[model samples]
Target: MKLLASGVFALATLMASSALAQAQAPANYGPAIPGVCVYYGAQTLAQSTVGQSVSTRMNALSQEVAGELAPYAQSIETEITALQQGRASIPPAELQSRSQAVEQRIREAQQLEQTRQNELRYTLDVQRRAIATAVDPIIVAVYQERGCGLLLDRESVYLMNPAMDITPTVIERLNVALPSLSFNRLQVPVDQQQAQ
Candidate 1:
């Protein structure tokens, strides 16, 4: 019985020691290290000179499309007016033919407008992506220059040291590296289309 009691006490002591060791061991929290810089991409883009240039170019393109569509708008209105006034005087067959022609023209104009809008949207997206890509090497250069081991997006962090914020520095670097991107429409590579 004494031996049994001694054995139980020894087992309890070993269990306690194991628990204490585990409590002292450092937790495996993730790959994040101390003193890494974080940047807000949206803020950086908005403040960058290239971003403003892109916005201005997009606005100009929109205005140009609107001006180009103005004549079609007037023609469509005139066609509608003519159809309404000639409904009684025009023979049934002639009226039907005119109606179909007017509908086809209107559809064509709408399709043309839609195509223009899509092209503009695609061009703007491509430009924005190009700007982001151009800024990537700059981001790496800045991160290395600042001696930060890690660079992360500001959105993921809830709180951080103000000194660890690198957005302003990144924006400055981007301004020097790339002042503006091409605002013109991007052409899809013909080789890529053929491959598809």
Candidate 2:
């Protein structure tokens, strides 16, 4: 009798929990409407005219920095070669000093490289923000026009209908709204870069 009573209690508890779960579950709204839409923000940025322009400018800046650093790199390489070639003739103490100096120069070169990278990153971030600022209104306008209730970043979505994606439309509007951006490499202070 006790076994039967316990079985009954367990069944009742399971039924109650199932009922609660059903009550808490959200309503399934089948078929996506304009009310729910997704967009690929990164793709829109990459394909947009202003984004391409920024990319080109960033590439140019990177190439320019590389060119500036090339001479220093070549000089370091030559020094290393000379050290290796003259290793036997040089006094032990002098060799140690020369090696230490070369190491210092290498460290300085690495620091300079890191600084240039930070500057490039800062410049790119500024340009991307500028582009976002310009496109924000256009995105808002489209959202309003489409009567969107929920805007989802495509990246967050696992599986979505192709029709729900508004990326191309957003890109089209972005191209019309912002054709190009004029900017230069941002020079970040050494202190600011180091703080990060």
Candidate 3:
């Protein structure tokens, strides 16, 4: 659960840094013109209604996974506490076996935690791709509508007129095109899970 929280924070931090970079762009790039435009893909995705829905859904899923694993965690903690309290009275051989069992349980819990994290990550990636898919044509349409010949990622630009940013237009069209997305946790295949 701590790992999941940290992962979410890391994602937020990355998005914030991206936005800051765009904000710090030099402001003297002359007046806006046709045939050239910038799009802040990260910011657009983060700010859009559908994107917020995805984020809310992901947090719910993370909480669900934590709840599902709570018993394993509790059981492990109980066993460890019992072992420590009775250590003086336990025979050496029995103590070794019990300790090994506890270790095995810990390892199993760790593996489960890792699997859950991987599933969450995979689910997020898939959803982000879906959102991107929905946003692509909208962006293209906006580009053509705005008569843009060069479409640059905001991340790649160090200077641009604020008016030249088509991100809001793209996001608006995306909200109309895809107001929300419904998805479930992606159950990664065994082979892929092991690879991760």
Candidate 4:
């Protein structure tokens, strides 16, 4: 078993509730939680690298909606700009018709954006929960081994006692014990109702 630093912020954030659980633990009852250690872990660096891919996936999903709406957006903006530049003067009949059409198109784009946003948001929420679930068993193993009373997100702790640091060890053990959720899973569109 490799040693793990428990205070890495990346893993810590996901395990913050465990920190509170630690505080509530009975004092001097070490026997009850043998092999338990007070620990934290970082996975931010790794997760951030994965996030770049996630970002790209989100941008790609936006493409379809954007494509559908681009002509409307572009046309409206062009007409507005032309009006500002005095490039075109419209009679009241044409002006009213153009204004209504522009409003309708704008609404369509806004609706599409809202739908896409909801789908992506739901997908992200599920994915994070999945990753957090994957890491839990490793946490339990380390807790059992170290006689740990609590676990915290590494980011929350400012001072690292080398004696207490177990990040690398935990990470290694976790890699073996638990398969990581996709470091970057592309979020695709879902129906607006399903997204909700």
- Most accurate candidate by TM-score: 3
Clashing pairs in 1: none
Write down the lDDT of every candidate, Cα atoms only: 0.73, 0.77, 0.86, 0.53
User: Which ranking of candidates, highest lDDT first?
Assistant: 3, 2, 1, 4
- For model 4, the run of ten residues with the poorest summed lDDT: 1-10
lDDT tens string, model 4, 98-184?
777777877887776665555555555565565456556766776667766666556676543434545556666655554333433
Which has the higher lDDT value, candidate number 1 or candidate number 4? Answer: 1
Provide the TM-score for each candidate, comma-separated. 0.70, 0.78, 0.87, 0.57
**lDDT by residue for model 2 over 74-193, one digit each (tens)?**
998998998999999999999899899989989999888777887887887898888889878877887778788888987687556556767788889889888888888788877877
Query: For residues 1-196, what per-residue lDDT tens digits would candidate 3 score against the true structure?
Result: 6655886786699688867866786757688987899998877767898988888898899999999899999999999999999999999899999999999999999989888888898898899899999999999898889899999998798777878899999888888888888888888888887787
Which residue pairs does candidate 2 place in steric collision? none
Query: Candidate 2: lDDT of 34?
Result: 59
Ranking by TM-score: 3, 2, 1, 4
For model 2, give the 10-residue run with minimal summed lDDT: 1-10
Residues 10-118 of candidate 1: C-alpha lDDT, one tens digit per residue: 5467457546755664554345455588977866656689876776676677777788888998998898899899899999999899899989989989977766666
lDDT, model 3, position 70: 95
TM-score of 4: 0.57
Q: In model 2, where do residues sit more than 4 Å from their true spots?
A: 1-31, 189-191
How high a TM-score does candidate 2 get?
0.78
Clashing pairs in 3: none
